[model samples]
Target: MYDAVEALEGRQFDVVYTGKGALCYLPDFAQWADVVHQLLKPGGSLYIVEFHPLLNAMGSVALPGDTDDLIIRNDYLEGRGAIAHDTTVTYTGDQIPGRQRSFEWMHSLGEVVTTLAATGFQITRLRESEVLQWPRFNGMHQTPKGWWRLPDEAPRIPLLYALLATKSD
Candidate 1:
């Protein structure tokens, strides 16, 4: 993103959209916000629809465990830098021929909002949803829209979130 900002050479856009777990791959929210700000024209908007951080706190779903209840197995507020991941299979239970190593950083919703606000973005919309595109846990149920969510008796938590912020004019 920083490279794109530089490569654009003063070019600005009417909107910038990012989502679907993209923020986790980024190490610095402040730097990202700076790049977004530079890329957008005055009054342009940045829209993000991503997996909620609460899902991160649940740890890896691939691990062997009973899904009878939700558990907090990881940190919600990330102060610990990058988390390393090594996996040989995809989330859909497909096996990979070789292990893949990756690093990700957790950014709380507060951090995301603060970074954008500090970067001169006026937050316009923030929405959290309990539905997910896939059934992340065994206890999840398919919604009418074909999305997945916890059963009615289960606690309602945010699985996804969408935020919209506009650059200050």
Candidate 2:
């Protein structure tokens, strides 16, 4: 963990991409922002494409019988700190022998933007999409382009979000 920042000591990058389910595992955005800032040169940019908090709060589940039901099973915003999960099964259908424990924290859009702004990064763009990379919910359909989206009859909800931030030159 400590070597992450050290790995890019004097090097600078034009762009950094972070995404999917990555943010939840990070307990400290300030430290993350600092590392990003250090690794980037002036005028560099950071692009993030991640799962929306609303989708995360809903808690993706396999609803084979009832595909239309949308439920909020978890907190939408950060309240009691990190949420802990202990399970043997992985998302990829793999079962481990030993105990598997993980911690995740939900971050609101406001918090995400403010953290980057506070770290001196300028927000360039923000986009929320109804399409997802995978069928997060049952009855999702795959488009010809390979993206998954809800049918026209289903309510439009943001399943993913992307944000671009740039450092001052």
Candidate 3:
């Protein structure tokens, strides 16, 4: 990873895009922001389309005997440190034969925007959507566009969010 960073040194990119379920693995926003800032050219942009922090905090695990209900099962903010999980099942209906452990950190929207701002990026756009790429919950339905969404009667929530930030010349 350090070698990749070094190879890109002094390089400028017109745009950088990061997708869903990526940010949770990053432990330090400041370090990430520094790398992004270094990669962008003057007036270049960074676009992040990711799962909303609220959705991450709520998690995709169905409540016991209540797969229809969404619950806050994790931290919504950063101060609590990393969360560790041990599982033998994968999200794609595959079962792992051996134990697996993973660690993740929750980052609020405020933290994202602030980190970019501190790194000298100007926030251009921010959008939140109720659409998801898969059925995160038991009763979600897929739309014509292939995205999943909560049923009409379910309370609306932001499942995904996108932000655009530009490095000024």
Question: Which candidate comes out best when scored by TM-score?
Answer: 1
Q: TM-score for candidate 2, please give it.
A: 0.87
Model 3 lDDT tens row, 1-169: 2233578766778998888888888888678878877888889899999889998877555547655577888888887888998889865658999988888888899999998998899999999999998888878999999999999998999999999999975
In model 1, which residue pairs have backbone atoms overlapping below 3 Å? none
Best by lDDT: 1
Compute each candidate's TM-score over C-alphas.
0.91, 0.87, 0.90
Residue clash pairs of candidate 3? none
Instruction: Write model 2 residue lDDT over 1-169, tens digit each, in one string.
Output: 3357687566889998997988888887778887887778899999999999898887544467655567888888876789888999876659999879989999888889998999989999999999987887767899999999988887898999999999975
Candidate with the larger lDDT of 1 and 3 = 1
Ranking by lDDT: 1, 3, 2
- Candidate 3 local lDDT, residue 104: 87
Each candidate: RMSD: 2.1, 2.5, 2.1
Kindly provide the TM-score of model 1 when superposed on the true structure, using C-alpha atoms: 0.91
